[model samples]
Target: MATKEFDELALDGTNYPIRASNIKINFASRGILNTIEEPNDGDPEIEPRKLNTALFLLRLYIHKDLKHEYMLETSPLNLWKALKERYDQQKELIWPEANYEWVHLRLQDFKTMAEYNHAVHNICSKLKFCEQEPTEAKKIEKTLSTMLPEDRILTQQYRTNNFQKHSLLIHTLTQAERHHELSLKNAQQRPPGSAPLPEVHFNVQNNAKNKKGFKGNSSNNPKNLTGKRKRNNNRRKFKDRKKGKGKDKAPQPRSNGNKHCNMCGSDTHVAKDCRIPKHLVLLYQKSLKDKKSSENPRFEAHFNLTHEERLEVASSHQAPVELESNINVLPEDVAPLSAMDDMFIEYCSTDPLGDLQ
Candidate 1:
């Protein structure tokens, strides 16, 4: 099976520490770290199985060329020791880089405080791996020294307040940066200036100017021109100008007074040009005919016709009720109304109103 969790460890003298660490972690996980850490002191017969397992893991992660050469080794412990001896020398080669990076680590070189903090931690880790870990004081001093020139005063302020704690210094820097970004954003959104007046204010001022001094026509009483009249006026004015009637002059009226149409009574057009609705003209002609033939009119309107129709409709669906006489008829056995009057006069003459006897 494939145990290649990482890139194959090249035979070249590069990137051996990280690869070896990964290999160790992989062996520890498989319960076979002991094969490399200690010898197989339990059983002689089981020794060959463990040796093959360890060799398989190592070969799975090593270069193809190194695989064939390392197969000749019979012991896992000696092979582990030999691999370390050949690859572990790169640490010395990495020391100069750690020192150079440490000297050049500048907070100003990174855009954010978080990025600078990350760089500091990363460089410190690299140094610690190479046995050159930085102290707390050295890290703070490095940060203070590498700040941008504009922030030199800010560094002094932090130090004056005894912000020797690296965490406190970082917190202060981050807060100050946040406040600075907010201020810049606010400044860009709206600058320091008086606000301009609204649209209605300008319109009112222009209207006031025109009302106070404009003399040819009052602003209140503008010439009411219909759309068609305005178009005709413009067409006639253009023709007149082409004929050299006048230049830069107001258009002349078509007549001494506006042409009044008798059909519709609109002053913009004469009777010939009037466009009265046909329904309205027809009704008018009907009114004249009705007046001329009032006694024998063509359209004879019956008054209260809807009431008569309603009574007819109500009786149409109902059966007729027969009656020989109405309730006003008196029966033969009843006395006449003259006898009723005599009885009433006799009852009245008896003096029922005399003292309550």
Candidate 2:
């Protein structure tokens, strides 16, 4: 199992060397295999009934971390071989098939660590391996067999047997392996006190000591309890009072005549009259007075204009004409000849030339 031999084996494309140095070795002179205490989970370190419980946990761990099925279509022998090859350097060796079979049968229907441990206890009873002496294997078997297969074996009460060993070991191992290394790199790395590792940090501020975030403020002070209750009662009372007042003030039926016009359509002038200009109103009044006066007999003289007078008035507005120089009339001839000549001309015009003589 030299490193060179392992390298050669790697060159040959075999996953594992024939004699890997890391494989578990039996240091005990008697050649009997050793059993290291299974890493104590914080649960009460109940004595294991069968070794397979540890193997189950280990297998589960490997499967989850490796993200692959441990023994898909693979025989139990192959699993044992692989386990021995990889982790044989560890203190506990996975037992041969006969012991494995005995352990596996007990664990087939195990639901919790307690049930599994009890099964281990049953096997230990038959095998007589544990320090706490086995008394009643038959009784345990009878009870377990008769119990419904679907029965939940774990309870909240037994959730953590709170093994001191597990707690201390986890703290030591995690700190030594992880936190310590991190602390060396980061000066502020403080190992978690003793709180259980949370799946998620739900409490943004971890004030578990004061219950600051875990419970509301009202829960802490008992004196404020009655006051809060009173406030809530007052709120309800106010709402009830409002509802009662609303009922009292319920709407009454409306009357028709009492309603007022929306516009200036009452005894007062309408919107058109209200908006009419003052000057326009004055003009309308004057026009009405004129119309009334025109219908009266007293205004007749004022109304009539005689024909000549009307003509004189009409001619006064006509465009003036200029007379030519040869058409000038003599004053005496034009003046006296006007009336008489008109008469003589009217008389003689009836007789032709004889009337003229």
Candidate 3:
């Protein structure tokens, strides 16, 4: 860490083979490598300071327990030799395990090319420290041989590239794996008819429940009466406008003592609750006409009939035309008024569906 060189490794005996190799690199950077390899006495002036710096680093990083044994050694060359002799046997001790790892290394065993690359490099590094480093071609062959059965064609292609270095082979594998993954993802994206939408589990916010309680949906809402009852309800609403609100509430007072008479002229007192029809209210009718009310207007209609037209109108209706009960029908040989007959004829003509039938 102190110098911009190969990092110092702890002098742990178990990993002494790699550790010693790293130490050599560390010493070489300090210009004190000759002190270790040539075993010469460093110059009393320049070499002593460089040797001392190297020796101090070596002493500082060694196993703390082993410090006492090498503390008395003054010369760096003797000290360096002493460390090698003590830990050099580590290479022989580690040789079999490193050989086995290199021999058994396989690309297929690793889930990713990165992991396979790391494994190959790790084993190669250890083998190199043990002085049995694998050749570039041998490492390349190892990868090809260990590939999955499905990747035989891919392995052959890599072999055909004549990769001169192990690193080039590793880069090729990584790039190939990337393209292969892209192909798989592309294949998965192909639509059969249309790509299925991701399943969503959600509720419509309008009718959804809150934290307080569950909400009422359309099905849970109050139901109105159906069929004939529904028709009766609509009729009742229209009728309510013509009449009063309900039988429960009282109507406007007609008492002479209370207010002026605006409808029918009557001397006898009428209960306040009694309803007065709008048709009897001349004042209201006058005001409504003055306002020219478009929403509600009464028009007197006309009626006329030809014999052929009468026959055709009669044929259009599915139900038997109830002549006597109809508003156009008159008793005692009296002719129906023009306005009444026209209303009945117009009602039939307006019903387009009934005309087709």
Candidate 4:
């Protein structure tokens, strides 16, 4: 019975000369060895057709120069033998030391496991053709040694377990590569020590509503009500002082131009009508008192004067106090005052009487 028909080999010239020659030899060994050795005179068509097919495939692989040189040969066996001789001669001419070095250097430089495996297999195949085939253990050892640092450990472990099967080793390494890629992806997805902060959005409408509610509750707040009463009482005391001064001396002609408030540095208002903070107003008043005491040391010496005498001096020489434009009263200046001082100032501001009884 005829043997099973093997698939016809298709060769491309780019394949290594050794690989192409091996394939051609395998094709001949399959069923055609006898037909190539002893020609059948009975069936002229069958033998020639098989030989021609082999010759056609061989022609497809060789370079144009080699094709022109070998195409004149009529016998398929002769043509195949001639091609083998040419490739063998070429292989013999190549330096074994150079080939060994080339293979060793490139085996280590492969970026991926698949590339490394393919290169190792191809080099081994070439070495086998040259009758220098390395053992499986040596191949495995070489592959593990040449791998990158991270991959070397896993490859070494597989080798230690005596997993000398090339296919199985490649599969395990491929799986490891996939796991490494997944780990890297996960690490990149969420950076270390970096979590998103919860956002707090402010609602302008709610703030406005709260402000309205505060204004509505102002009358109910004891501090606000007391402050309003104190302001009104102060205004009445000021008006009373002005009336008393008017009675003593005829008022001088008031300027028609707008008055600039020395306290607030505003042209729209006078100093008396200035809305300067209570703390700043008290500080300004203290400064004025200090200046007057310095200019007239006699006034400070007469501190034991009767209440009526002090009032007389205060009303007669009421000098217009001017605040410096550059004076800035920050919250920190008033913050240092003791509770007792704050209470006394609050009491003095609320009191209807301007001075000590």
Write the number of the candidate with greater TM-score, choosing between 1 and 3: 3
Error of 3 at 1 (Å): 12
RMSD of 1: 34.7
Cα lDDT, all candidates: 0.73, 0.42, 0.71, 0.63
Give the per-residue Cα lDDT of candidate 4 at 325.
70
If ranked by TM-score, best first, what sequence of candidates would result?
3, 1, 4, 2
Clashes of each: 0, 9, 3, 0
| Tens-digit lDDT string for candidate 2 (320-343) | 355576665566546565456556
Tens-place lDDT digits, model 4, residues 1-357? 333233322233233455555554756675554434545678555467767766665555556777778769877667767765655554454448436743565444866778877777766666666667778767666666667677566656776778666667677777888898899997887778788554555577667777775655778889899999999999998998877843466666465467877775556679888888978877877887899988875434424333343455443334445677757654664664454464644233422355535
Spell out the clash pairs found in candidate 1: none
Q: Which runs in model 1 stand beyond 4 Å of their true positions? A: 1-4, 38-54, 160-172, 193-357
lDDT of 4: 0.63
lDDT of 3 by residue, 1-357 (tens): 565343344556776665676777777776777766664466544467887887787776677767887789887778878888887877887789989998888888999999988888888877887889989889988989999999788778887889998888888778978998998897788665677675454544533555338456544544533455778988998898778655656566454655434344443434353366757666665776777855554443432222333465543323424466667555766655764655645245544446534
lDDT of 1 by residue, 58-161 (tens): 77788878777787876777777878888777778777887899998888899999998888777776677688988877877888888989988988977687
Model 2 scores worst on lDDT over the 10 consecutive residues at 2-11
Tell me the TM-score of model 2: 0.14
